[model samples]
Target: MTDEHRSGCPINLSLEVFGDKWSLLILRDMIFGAQRHFRDLQKGSQEGIASNILASRLKHLVELGMLTKRPDPAHKQKAIYSLTEASIQLVPVMAALGSWGLRWQPASEELSIRAQLLEEGGPELWNRFMAELRDEHLGIPAEPSADGKLVRERLQEAYLAVLAERGKSLPSKA
Candidate 1:
């Protein structure tokens, strides 16, 4: 929708919208880390995104319908960004990418723990995660089940456990 594509390829079309590192990283923070505010996304970013780049990618994602932005009720000047259903569906893709990264790239244990859990959890876990996302971002009730661990909570727990093992304090939740 931003511009005419060179081809009708699906991958190419996806790349045009979210191919860049920053955009995906932004989505990752929103999906996994539950960062909704602009400052939270900027500061909580492990990759240390610049202010202008974060602004641009946020705008681009909104334009592409991957995200929606609105004024934060608690903070008059700040905006809250939420993932659209289209972006919510990217959970599996993110999991695959994380799995690949864990295999091929050097990743810190705490950072890559979610990927490990997701790879081990497979599709069922991904579905639960998507359900949880819908609950958080869309105000839909999460599927009723006996499984007590929300995917986000489990990932945070894993991260905290790793940090505790290393004698590090858990970073304050954003």
Candidate 2:
């Protein structure tokens, strides 16, 4: 981070703010995936970060105008967080990075499912999904889910099952 930069490059500034590994993960959680609170981000990430690191990253992101925090009506003491337009606009960046990871970096078949979902679904699906996330996070109108249409829940269930299997099938995976 100490590497000096003189001129003003937008990309350079972006990387300076969110170029690190964990910051993007936080964005991924909020925008593409389901994450609202501190605990959710920590539990869902594969690269386990300490509690202090997670707190610092959250604070950094808030300061960067990528996220906003609001008081939870139900829980007076706790704050429920959501993404700003700046962060939600990172959908393309998220899509590109996911595609890049699947291409160059070999992740598990299960891990690749998320990438596949975004890649195969294209922009329309991604936009709709992000719209739903925006609605939920912003405390706006939320679309009602079908009786049994559990998309993320199903994926998470499968991921948990994969964890329980624990190297039984994915010997080549990281």
Candidate 3:
């Protein structure tokens, strides 16, 4: 439905919205890393995204209906970004992409751990993750679980563990 579609092809249409290198990285941070603020996204980016590029992509994503931006209640001058349902549905796509990357690319173990877990866990894990994302971004109640290990926490723990093994501490929060 976007005016910028190059063709009727589904892949082309999807690429039109998120084809750029930076957009999906931004979404990945939001979806997997739970980084909602612009400053956090810029500073915490493992790929070192430029500030201007991050700003532009955030605006583009909001315009394309993948994200919503609203004033942060805790900070008057700051904005909080949240994923829309469309972006939430991208969980499986991201998992698949990560799976492919892990198989063929030279990704580091710490970085690829989540993808490995996702590929192994399959749809059931992805569904739980999507449900958690909805709870975080859409204010919906996440399904209750007996075991309290959140996917996000597990990923972070893995990253931290790698850092610990490397004798590198987590970066100080801004």
Candidate 4:
């Protein structure tokens, strides 16, 4: 990014930080999949992000205060990345983007289920999910759920169910 933004608009400022697909994807992986380590982020990428690009983006994110990186206790050579409070506040944005994709794009059922559920759940789910994110990344306590299931767990379960149904119905390779 340039030293100066094109405009002082909030949207413009946000775009400066999240304008590229890779950056958003990195954030998405961290937020949705909990992929923290460099290798995990690279492997979790659906779009096959190159190592150089991933490394560049990770460094950029850390520099921009979206993520924090430190030595991993499990492996001395590896680093653990954590989302900062600023990035944790992006759950609603992700949900909105997913919702828009589901409505306007030719998204598959298995991939679109989480978006569908998030849109259906609306702000309530978004708030709860954000709370859970805080719990995971920020060490903030999450609000207790009535059913004892996390919002993430619920979202993952829905995605898996859709995948299972799709697998059963799709023609198998011969």
Q: Mark the regions of model 2 whose C-alpha exceeds 4 Å error after superposition.
A: 1-6, 140-174
Q: All candidates' TM-scores?
A: 0.93, 0.76, 0.92, 0.92
Relative to the true structure, candidate 2 reaches a TM of 0.76
lDDT of each: 0.92, 0.73, 0.90, 0.88
lDDT of 1 by residue, 86-161 (tens): 9999999999999999999999888888999999999999999999999999888997657677889988999889
Error of 3 at 164 (Å): 2.8
Candidate 1 segments exceeding 4 Å error? 1-3, 144-147, 170-174
How does candidate 1 fare on TM-score?
A: 0.93
Better of 2 and 4 by lDDT: 4
Report the lDDT tens digits of candidate 4 across residue range 64-132.
Answer: 999999999999999999999889889889999999999999997888989999899999998998888
TM-score of 4: 0.92
For model 2, how does the per-residue alpha-carbon lDDT over 122-143 read when each residue is reduced to its tens digit?
A: 7865666666666766655546
Q: Who is ahead in TM-score, 2 or 3?
A: 3
lDDT of 3 by residue, 1-174 (tens): 566666889999899888888998999999998999999999888788988999999999999999999999999999999999999999999999999999999998778788988999899989999999999999999976567877788778888888888888776554
**Candidate 4 error regions (>4 Å):** 1-3, 168-174
The predicted structure with the larger TM-score, 2 or 4, is 4
Best by lDDT: 1
User: Would you list the clashing residue pairs of candidate 2?
Assistant: none
